[model samples]
Target: MTSTADSYFVCATPRTGSSLLLGLLESTGVAGRPQAYFREPGEPMWAGRWGLPSTAGYDEYVRAALAAGRTDNGVFGAKLMWGTLDLVVDRLGAVHPGLAGHDVELLERAFGRTRFVYLWRDDVLAQAVSWLRAEQTRLWEADGEAEPGGHAPGYDAAGIEELVERIGEHNAAWERWFASCGVQPHRVRYEDLDADQTGVTRGILAFLGLDLPEGRKIAPSHRRQSDELNAAWIERYSRESARS
Candidate 1:
Protein backbone atom coordinates (compact mmCIF):
# COMPACT_ATOMS: atom_id res chain seq x y z
CA MET A 1 0.00 0.00 0.00
CA THR A 2 2.90 2.33 0.74
CA SER A 3 4.79 3.57 -2.30
CA THR A 4 8.22 5.04 -1.79
CA ALA A 5 9.16 7.91 -4.05
CA ASP A 6 11.72 6.51 -6.49
CA SER A 7 13.40 9.88 -7.06
CA TYR A 8 14.20 13.13 -5.23
CA PHE A 9 11.53 14.79 -3.14
CA VAL A 10 11.01 18.39 -2.03
CA CYS A 11 9.25 18.37 1.31
CA ALA A 12 8.44 21.73 2.83
CA THR A 13 5.67 23.68 4.48
CA PRO A 14 3.27 25.20 2.00
CA ARG A 15 3.50 28.87 0.94
CA THR A 16 7.21 28.78 1.63
CA GLY A 17 7.99 29.64 -1.97
CA SER A 18 8.24 25.96 -2.87
CA SER A 19 6.61 26.67 -6.21
CA LEU A 20 9.11 29.35 -7.10
CA LEU A 21 11.87 27.10 -5.88
CA LEU A 22 10.45 24.35 -8.07
CA GLY A 23 10.49 26.73 -11.02
CA LEU A 24 14.13 27.55 -10.36
CA LEU A 25 15.02 23.86 -10.07
CA GLU A 26 13.08 23.09 -13.23
CA SER A 27 14.80 25.94 -15.01
CA THR A 28 18.10 24.36 -14.10
CA GLY A 29 16.68 21.15 -15.58
CA VAL A 30 16.88 19.27 -12.28
CA ALA A 31 13.25 19.28 -11.12
CA GLY A 32 10.01 18.23 -12.74
CA ARG A 33 6.37 18.98 -12.04
CA PRO A 34 4.42 16.09 -10.56
CA GLN A 35 2.07 14.09 -12.72
CA ALA A 36 -0.69 13.96 -10.13
CA TYR A 37 -3.49 13.18 -12.55
CA PHE A 38 -3.84 9.44 -12.03
CA ARG A 39 -2.57 6.83 -9.57
CA GLU A 40 -4.01 3.85 -11.47
CA PRO A 41 -7.00 3.21 -13.72
CA GLY A 42 -10.04 5.13 -12.42
CA GLU A 43 -7.94 6.49 -9.55
CA PRO A 44 -6.33 9.89 -9.92
CA MET A 45 -3.25 10.99 -8.01
CA TRP A 46 -4.56 14.56 -7.89
CA ALA A 47 -8.15 13.52 -8.54
CA GLY A 48 -9.64 16.23 -10.73
CA ARG A 49 -7.13 18.83 -9.70
CA TRP A 50 -5.01 20.78 -12.21
CA GLY A 51 -5.06 18.02 -14.80
CA LEU A 52 -1.79 16.50 -13.55
CA PRO A 53 -0.69 13.21 -15.12
CA SER A 54 -1.45 9.84 -13.53
CA THR A 55 1.29 7.63 -12.08
CA ALA A 56 0.54 4.74 -14.42
CA GLY A 57 0.74 7.06 -17.41
CA TYR A 58 4.02 8.41 -16.11
CA ASP A 59 6.24 5.41 -16.86
CA GLU A 60 8.61 7.55 -18.97
CA TYR A 61 8.49 10.16 -16.28
CA VAL A 62 9.91 7.79 -13.67
CA ARG A 63 12.57 6.58 -16.03
CA ALA A 64 13.55 10.13 -16.93
CA ALA A 65 13.68 11.10 -13.27
CA LEU A 66 15.91 8.13 -12.36
CA ALA A 67 18.16 8.81 -15.30
CA ALA A 68 18.45 12.44 -14.29
CA GLY A 69 19.70 11.36 -10.87
CA ARG A 70 22.26 8.87 -12.21
CA THR A 71 23.52 11.18 -14.93
CA ASP A 72 24.81 14.74 -14.49
CA ASN A 73 22.09 16.16 -16.68
CA GLY A 74 20.21 17.81 -13.83
CA VAL A 75 18.86 17.40 -10.31
CA PHE A 76 15.57 15.52 -10.43
CA GLY A 77 13.23 16.92 -7.83
CA ALA A 78 9.49 16.88 -7.04
CA LYS A 79 7.65 19.43 -4.95
CA LEU A 80 5.78 17.71 -2.13
CA MET A 81 3.28 19.98 -0.48
CA TRP A 82 1.60 19.13 2.81
CA GLY A 83 -1.29 17.59 0.88
CA THR A 84 1.01 15.26 -1.01
CA LEU A 85 2.93 14.42 2.14
CA ASP A 86 -0.32 13.61 3.89
CA LEU A 87 -1.35 11.30 1.07
CA VAL A 88 1.96 9.51 1.12
CA VAL A 89 1.84 9.37 4.89
CA ASP A 90 -1.62 7.89 4.76
CA ARG A 91 -0.68 5.24 2.24
CA LEU A 92 2.64 4.47 3.86
CA GLY A 93 1.10 4.42 7.31
CA ALA A 94 -1.24 1.70 6.14
CA VAL A 95 1.83 -0.32 5.14
CA HIS A 96 3.87 0.62 8.22
CA PRO A 97 1.64 1.47 11.13
CA GLY A 98 3.92 4.08 12.72
CA LEU A 99 5.12 5.69 9.52
CA ALA A 100 3.12 8.82 10.30
CA GLY A 101 5.25 9.31 13.39
CA HIS A 102 8.36 9.34 11.20
CA ASP A 103 7.27 10.64 7.80
CA VAL A 104 10.52 12.42 7.03
CA GLU A 105 12.68 9.55 8.18
CA LEU A 106 10.70 6.96 6.23
CA LEU A 107 11.02 9.19 3.15
CA GLU A 108 14.78 9.55 3.59
CA ARG A 109 15.22 5.83 4.08
CA ALA A 110 13.11 5.13 1.02
CA PHE A 111 15.08 7.41 -1.25
CA GLY A 112 18.75 6.94 -0.45
CA ARG A 113 21.01 9.94 -1.04
CA THR A 114 17.98 12.15 -1.54
CA ARG A 115 18.19 15.87 -0.69
CA PHE A 116 15.48 18.05 0.87
CA VAL A 117 15.14 21.80 1.11
CA TYR A 118 13.06 22.91 4.10
CA LEU A 119 12.10 26.55 3.69
CA TRP A 120 10.74 28.57 6.57
CA ARG A 121 10.49 32.13 7.70
CA ASP A 122 11.51 33.11 11.24
CA ASP A 123 8.44 35.26 11.89
CA VAL A 124 5.73 33.01 13.27
CA LEU A 125 2.88 35.52 13.26
CA ALA A 126 3.63 36.49 9.71
CA GLN A 127 3.32 32.91 8.61
CA ALA A 128 -0.10 32.70 10.27
CA VAL A 129 -1.25 35.83 8.50
CA SER A 130 0.00 34.39 5.24
CA TRP A 131 -1.88 31.20 5.91
CA LEU A 132 -5.07 33.16 6.40
CA ARG A 133 -4.56 34.99 3.15
CA ALA A 134 -3.94 31.70 1.35
CA GLU A 135 -7.11 30.23 2.81
CA GLN A 136 -9.05 33.24 1.57
CA THR A 137 -7.55 32.84 -1.87
CA ARG A 138 -8.41 29.19 -1.95
CA LEU A 139 -11.99 29.84 -0.96
CA TRP A 140 -12.32 32.52 -3.59
CA GLU A 141 -10.74 30.37 -6.27
CA ALA A 142 -12.93 27.43 -5.42
CA ASP A 143 -16.02 29.61 -5.69
CA GLY A 144 -14.87 30.69 -9.17
CA GLU A 145 -14.53 34.26 -7.99
CA ALA A 146 -11.60 36.61 -8.47
CA GLU A 147 -8.79 36.55 -5.90
CA PRO A 148 -8.91 39.15 -3.18
CA GLY A 149 -6.41 41.99 -3.67
CA GLY A 150 -6.36 43.02 0.00
CA HIS A 151 -6.69 41.48 3.43
CA ALA A 152 -10.13 39.96 3.97
CA PRO A 153 -10.52 41.07 7.59
CA GLY A 154 -8.52 41.29 10.80
CA TYR A 155 -8.21 38.11 12.83
CA ASP A 156 -9.85 37.75 16.23
CA ALA A 157 -7.61 36.93 19.18
CA ALA A 158 -8.74 33.30 19.23
CA GLY A 159 -8.21 33.00 15.50
CA ILE A 160 -4.73 34.46 15.69
CA GLU A 161 -3.77 32.29 18.67
CA GLU A 162 -5.08 29.14 17.04
CA LEU A 163 -3.23 29.88 13.79
CA VAL A 164 0.09 30.51 15.51
CA GLU A 165 -0.15 27.39 17.63
CA ARG A 166 -0.98 25.22 14.64
CA ILE A 167 1.85 26.55 12.49
CA GLY A 168 4.32 26.37 15.38
CA GLU A 169 3.40 22.74 15.90
CA HIS A 170 3.93 21.98 12.24
CA ASN A 171 7.28 23.73 12.30
CA ALA A 172 8.35 21.97 15.45
CA ALA A 173 7.29 18.62 14.05
CA TRP A 174 9.46 18.93 10.92
CA GLU A 175 12.43 20.39 12.83
CA ARG A 176 12.52 17.47 15.24
CA TRP A 177 12.01 14.95 12.46
CA PHE A 178 14.89 16.37 10.45
CA ALA A 179 17.17 16.30 13.51
CA SER A 180 16.31 12.71 14.31
CA CYS A 181 17.30 11.64 10.84
CA GLY A 182 20.75 13.24 11.35
CA VAL A 183 20.34 14.85 7.98
CA GLN A 184 21.45 18.45 7.96
CA PRO A 185 18.64 19.81 5.84
CA HIS A 186 19.26 22.93 3.81
CA ARG A 187 17.28 25.92 5.08
CA VAL A 188 16.22 29.00 3.16
CA ARG A 189 14.68 31.95 4.88
CA TYR A 190 12.04 33.68 2.77
CA GLU A 191 13.35 37.15 3.53
CA ASP A 192 16.94 36.27 2.76
CA LEU A 193 15.97 34.54 -0.46
CA ASP A 194 14.01 37.65 -1.40
CA ALA A 195 16.61 40.19 -0.31
CA ASP A 196 19.75 38.53 -1.64
CA GLN A 197 18.93 36.59 -4.76
CA THR A 198 22.48 35.75 -5.81
CA GLY A 199 23.67 34.50 -2.45
CA VAL A 200 20.53 32.54 -1.61
CA THR A 201 20.49 30.96 -5.06
CA ARG A 202 24.16 30.07 -4.73
CA GLY A 203 23.43 28.41 -1.41
CA ILE A 204 20.54 26.52 -2.95
CA LEU A 205 22.72 25.44 -5.86
CA ALA A 206 25.36 24.28 -3.43
CA PHE A 207 22.83 22.32 -1.41
CA LEU A 208 21.68 20.62 -4.57
CA GLY A 209 25.35 19.84 -5.27
CA LEU A 210 25.24 21.40 -8.71
CA ASP A 211 27.50 23.99 -10.29
CA LEU A 212 25.89 27.29 -11.18
CA PRO A 213 25.93 27.83 -14.87
CA GLU A 214 27.93 30.88 -15.93
CA GLY A 215 26.01 34.16 -16.10
CA ARG A 216 22.60 32.66 -15.37
CA LYS A 217 20.69 35.39 -13.63
CA ILE A 218 18.62 34.13 -10.75
CA ALA A 219 15.61 36.39 -10.98
CA PRO A 220 14.35 38.08 -7.83
CA SER A 221 10.63 37.84 -8.59
CA HIS A 222 10.60 34.08 -9.01
CA ARG A 223 8.83 33.03 -5.80
CA ARG A 224 5.38 31.52 -5.16
CA GLN A 225 2.52 33.73 -6.27
CA SER A 226 1.71 35.70 -3.15
CA ASP A 227 0.08 39.06 -3.63
CA GLU A 228 -0.37 42.24 -1.59
CA LEU A 229 -3.45 40.64 -0.02
CA ASN A 230 -1.22 38.15 1.77
CA ALA A 231 1.02 40.86 3.30
CA ALA A 232 -0.65 40.58 6.71
CA TRP A 233 -0.39 36.79 6.73
CA ILE A 234 3.23 36.64 7.86
CA GLU A 235 2.93 39.71 10.06
CA ARG A 236 -0.04 38.39 12.03
CA TYR A 237 1.49 34.95 12.37
CA SER A 238 4.80 36.36 13.63
CA ARG A 239 3.15 38.64 16.14
CA GLU A 240 0.95 35.93 17.54
CA SER A 241 3.85 33.50 17.86
CA ALA A 242 6.02 36.07 19.62
CA ARG A 243 3.29 36.86 22.14
CA SER A 244 3.00 33.20 23.04
Candidate 2:
Protein backbone atom coordinates (compact mmCIF):
# COMPACT_ATOMS: atom_id res chain seq x y z
CA MET A 1 0.00 0.00 0.00
CA THR A 2 1.29 3.45 -0.93
CA SER A 3 1.39 5.67 2.14
CA THR A 4 1.15 9.44 2.08
CA ALA A 5 3.44 9.83 5.07
CA ASP A 6 6.39 7.56 5.62
CA SER A 7 6.61 8.37 9.31
CA TYR A 8 4.54 10.07 11.98
CA PHE A 9 4.95 11.05 15.66
CA VAL A 10 2.19 11.44 18.16
CA CYS A 11 3.10 14.71 19.92
CA ALA A 12 1.49 14.63 23.32
CA THR A 13 1.56 15.36 27.04
CA PRO A 14 0.68 12.96 29.85
CA ARG A 15 -2.97 12.05 30.51
CA THR A 16 -3.91 13.05 26.96
CA GLY A 17 -5.19 9.67 25.79
CA SER A 18 -2.09 9.07 23.69
CA SER A 19 -1.95 5.39 24.64
CA LEU A 20 -5.49 4.92 23.41
CA LEU A 21 -4.82 6.76 20.17
CA LEU A 22 -1.63 4.86 19.47
CA GLY A 23 -3.37 1.58 20.28
CA LEU A 24 -6.16 2.32 17.85
CA LEU A 25 -3.67 3.23 15.13
CA GLU A 26 -1.60 0.12 15.78
CA SER A 27 -4.66 -2.13 15.71
CA THR A 28 -5.16 -1.18 12.06
CA GLY A 29 -1.88 -2.99 11.26
CA VAL A 30 -1.19 -0.38 8.57
CA ALA A 31 -0.20 2.47 10.84
CA GLY A 32 3.22 2.05 12.36
CA ARG A 33 3.67 0.65 15.89
CA PRO A 34 3.77 3.93 17.76
CA GLN A 35 5.52 4.02 21.13
CA ALA A 36 7.54 6.51 23.14
CA TYR A 37 11.01 5.72 21.89
CA PHE A 38 12.74 8.97 22.83
CA ARG A 39 11.64 9.66 26.35
CA GLU A 40 14.85 11.18 27.77
CA PRO A 41 15.07 9.37 31.10
CA GLY A 42 13.92 6.07 29.62
CA GLU A 43 16.56 6.16 26.86
CA PRO A 44 18.86 3.65 28.53
CA MET A 45 15.98 1.28 29.30
CA TRP A 46 14.65 1.51 25.77
CA ALA A 47 18.11 0.87 24.36
CA GLY A 48 18.40 -2.24 26.52
CA ARG A 49 14.99 -3.46 25.36
CA TRP A 50 15.93 -2.86 21.70
CA GLY A 51 19.14 -4.89 22.11
CA LEU A 52 21.30 -1.82 21.71
CA PRO A 53 24.25 -1.54 24.05
CA SER A 54 24.05 1.20 26.69
CA THR A 55 26.95 2.94 24.95
CA ALA A 56 25.16 2.87 21.59
CA GLY A 57 25.41 6.14 19.70
CA TYR A 58 22.44 8.36 18.99
CA ASP A 59 22.27 7.34 15.31
CA GLU A 60 22.18 3.68 16.27
CA TYR A 61 19.33 4.34 18.65
CA VAL A 62 17.37 6.09 15.92
CA ARG A 63 17.85 3.15 13.58
CA ALA A 64 16.58 0.69 16.19
CA ALA A 65 13.58 2.88 16.95
CA LEU A 66 12.68 3.17 13.28
CA ALA A 67 12.96 -0.56 12.72
CA ALA A 68 10.88 -1.27 15.80
CA GLY A 69 8.18 1.27 14.97
CA ARG A 70 7.65 0.58 11.29
CA THR A 71 4.93 -1.70 10.01
CA ASP A 72 5.22 -4.18 7.16
CA ASN A 73 4.06 -1.48 4.76
CA GLY A 74 7.10 0.66 5.65
CA VAL A 75 5.27 3.25 7.71
CA PHE A 76 6.93 4.38 10.95
CA GLY A 77 5.27 5.92 14.01
CA ALA A 78 6.36 7.14 17.46
CA LYS A 79 5.19 9.19 20.38
CA LEU A 80 7.01 12.44 21.19
CA MET A 81 6.20 14.10 24.45
CA TRP A 82 7.03 17.78 24.84
CA GLY A 83 9.35 17.15 27.76
CA THR A 84 11.63 14.92 25.71
CA LEU A 85 11.58 16.89 22.46
CA ASP A 86 14.78 18.75 23.23
CA LEU A 87 16.77 15.61 24.04
CA VAL A 88 15.63 13.90 20.82
CA VAL A 89 16.43 16.97 18.74
CA ASP A 90 19.84 17.47 20.36
CA ARG A 91 20.73 13.82 19.77
CA LEU A 92 19.51 13.99 16.18
CA GLY A 93 21.74 17.02 15.71
CA ALA A 94 24.77 14.96 16.72
CA VAL A 95 24.01 12.47 13.97
CA HIS A 96 23.56 15.12 11.29
CA PRO A 97 25.86 17.97 12.17
CA GLY A 98 25.01 19.90 9.02
CA LEU A 99 21.33 20.04 10.07
CA ALA A 100 22.21 20.67 13.69
CA GLY A 101 20.66 24.13 13.55
CA HIS A 102 17.44 22.95 11.91
CA ASP A 103 14.91 20.88 13.86
CA VAL A 104 12.47 20.05 11.05
CA GLU A 105 15.15 19.24 8.55
CA LEU A 106 16.95 17.17 11.14
CA LEU A 107 13.79 15.10 11.75
CA GLU A 108 13.13 14.64 8.04
CA ARG A 109 16.68 13.46 7.56
CA ALA A 110 16.19 10.73 10.16
CA PHE A 111 12.50 9.93 9.64
CA GLY A 112 11.55 10.50 6.01
CA ARG A 113 8.33 12.28 5.08
CA THR A 114 7.51 12.79 8.74
CA ARG A 115 4.14 13.95 10.03
CA PHE A 116 3.04 15.12 13.50
CA VAL A 117 -0.10 14.25 15.42
CA TYR A 118 -0.90 16.59 18.31
CA LEU A 119 -2.85 14.63 20.92
CA TRP A 120 -4.17 16.55 23.92
CA ARG A 121 -7.10 16.93 26.24
CA ASP A 122 -9.32 19.99 26.08
CA ASP A 123 -10.23 19.80 29.75
CA VAL A 124 -7.16 20.80 31.68
CA LEU A 125 -8.65 19.97 35.06
CA ALA A 126 -9.55 16.46 34.10
CA GLN A 127 -6.18 15.94 32.46
CA ALA A 128 -4.38 17.20 35.52
CA VAL A 129 -6.42 14.99 37.80
CA SER A 130 -5.70 11.96 35.69
CA TRP A 131 -1.98 12.72 35.55
CA LEU A 132 -1.72 13.08 39.33
CA ARG A 133 -3.51 9.79 39.88
CA ALA A 134 -1.35 7.97 37.35
CA GLU A 135 1.82 9.32 38.92
CA GLN A 136 0.80 8.13 42.36
CA THR A 137 -0.51 4.80 41.18
CA ARG A 138 2.35 4.07 38.79
CA LEU A 139 -0.30 2.77 36.45
CA TRP A 140 0.07 4.84 33.32
CA GLU A 141 -2.27 2.67 31.29
CA ALA A 142 -4.91 -0.04 31.57
CA ASP A 143 -2.91 -2.59 29.58
CA GLY A 144 -2.76 -4.93 32.61
CA GLU A 145 0.86 -3.91 33.14
CA ALA A 146 2.51 -1.30 35.29
CA GLU A 147 5.74 0.32 36.22
CA PRO A 148 7.20 -0.73 39.58
CA GLY A 149 6.17 0.88 42.89
CA GLY A 150 2.44 1.45 42.56
CA HIS A 151 0.05 2.38 45.41
CA ALA A 152 -3.46 3.71 45.78
CA PRO A 153 -3.42 7.30 44.60
CA GLY A 154 -4.67 10.03 46.88
CA TYR A 155 -6.17 13.39 45.90
CA ASP A 156 -4.61 16.73 46.59
CA ALA A 157 -5.92 19.91 45.01
CA ALA A 158 -2.52 21.53 45.25
CA GLY A 159 -0.93 18.69 43.35
CA ILE A 160 -3.58 18.90 40.66
CA GLU A 161 -3.07 22.65 40.37
CA GLU A 162 0.67 22.21 39.91
CA LEU A 163 0.17 19.68 37.15
CA VAL A 164 -2.38 21.90 35.43
CA GLU A 165 0.26 24.60 35.16
CA ARG A 166 2.88 22.15 33.97
CA ILE A 167 0.52 20.73 31.41
CA GLY A 168 -0.25 24.20 30.08
CA GLU A 169 3.43 25.05 29.84
CA HIS A 170 4.23 21.87 27.98
CA ASN A 171 1.36 22.42 25.57
CA ALA A 172 2.47 25.97 24.95
CA ALA A 173 5.96 24.75 24.21
CA TRP A 174 4.52 22.39 21.59
CA GLU A 175 2.60 25.26 20.02
CA ARG A 176 5.68 27.43 19.90
CA TRP A 177 7.74 24.67 18.33
CA PHE A 178 5.03 23.97 15.74
CA ALA A 179 4.77 27.65 14.86
CA SER A 180 8.54 27.95 14.57
CA CYS A 181 8.61 24.97 12.23
CA GLY A 182 5.55 26.20 10.32
CA VAL A 183 4.14 22.70 10.68
CA GLN A 184 0.46 22.17 11.33
CA PRO A 185 -0.01 18.85 13.11
CA HIS A 186 -3.11 16.65 12.98
CA ARG A 187 -4.89 17.51 16.22
CA VAL A 188 -6.73 14.82 18.18
CA ARG A 189 -8.62 15.78 21.31
CA TYR A 190 -8.98 13.24 24.10
CA GLU A 191 -12.70 13.89 24.45
CA ASP A 192 -13.35 13.36 20.77
CA LEU A 193 -11.23 10.22 20.73
CA ASP A 194 -13.04 8.86 23.76
CA ALA A 195 -16.47 9.58 22.31
CA ASP A 196 -15.77 8.11 18.88
CA GLN A 197 -12.75 5.86 19.01
CA THR A 198 -13.41 4.28 15.62
CA GLY A 199 -14.23 7.57 13.95
CA VAL A 200 -11.06 9.22 15.14
CA THR A 201 -8.99 6.20 14.19
CA ARG A 202 -10.49 6.22 10.71
CA GLY A 203 -9.82 9.93 10.36
CA ILE A 204 -6.14 9.38 11.16
CA LEU A 205 -5.91 6.54 8.59
CA ALA A 206 -7.52 8.80 6.02
CA PHE A 207 -4.95 11.44 6.88
CA LEU A 208 -2.21 8.88 6.31
CA GLY A 209 -3.82 7.88 2.99
CA LEU A 210 -4.36 4.31 4.14
CA ASP A 211 -7.68 2.56 4.13
CA LEU A 212 -8.61 0.43 7.12
CA PRO A 213 -9.00 -3.07 5.75
CA GLU A 214 -12.59 -4.11 5.22
CA GLY A 215 -13.94 -5.87 8.34
CA ARG A 216 -11.02 -4.66 10.42
CA LYS A 217 -12.16 -3.49 13.84
CA ILE A 218 -10.58 -0.84 16.03
CA ALA A 219 -10.58 -1.48 19.76
CA PRO A 220 -8.79 0.40 22.55
CA SER A 221 -5.96 -1.64 23.96
CA HIS A 222 -6.36 -0.01 27.38
CA ARG A 223 -9.53 0.60 29.34
CA ARG A 224 -10.43 4.07 30.57
CA GLN A 225 -8.65 4.81 33.86
CA SER A 226 -10.95 7.53 35.04
CA ASP A 227 -13.68 6.86 37.60
CA GLU A 228 -16.10 8.65 39.94
CA LEU A 229 -13.19 9.70 42.15
CA ASN A 230 -11.52 11.25 39.13
CA ALA A 231 -14.75 13.07 38.42
CA ALA A 232 -14.88 14.34 42.00
CA TRP A 233 -11.32 15.60 41.80
CA ILE A 234 -12.04 17.45 38.61
CA GLU A 235 -15.14 19.01 40.09
CA ARG A 236 -13.34 19.91 43.28
CA TYR A 237 -10.47 21.43 41.39
CA SER A 238 -12.89 23.44 39.29
CA ARG A 239 -14.61 24.77 42.36
CA GLU A 240 -11.39 25.50 44.22
CA SER A 241 -9.77 27.07 41.20
CA ALA A 242 -12.77 29.20 40.51
CA ARG A 243 -12.87 30.42 44.08
CA SER A 244 -9.17 31.25 44.03
- In model 1, the Cα lDDT at residue 234 comes to 51
TM-score to native of every candidate shown: 0.63, 0.95
Candidates' lDDT values, in order? 0.54, 0.89
- Total backbone clashes of model 1? 18
Model 1 score (lDDT) = 0.54
lDDT at 5 for candidate 1?
26
> Clash totals for all models, in order?
18, 0
lDDT tens digits by residue: candidate 2, 97-209:
99997998999999999888899899988899999999888888876566788888887988998999999999999999999999998889989999999999998888888
Model 2, runs deviating above 4 Å: none
In candidate 1, stretches whose alpha carbon ends up further than 4 angstroms from where it belongs are: 1-8, 31-74, 81-86, 89-112, 139-157, 220-244
Worst 10 residues of 1 by lDDT: 34-43
Overall local distance difference test of candidate 2? 0.89
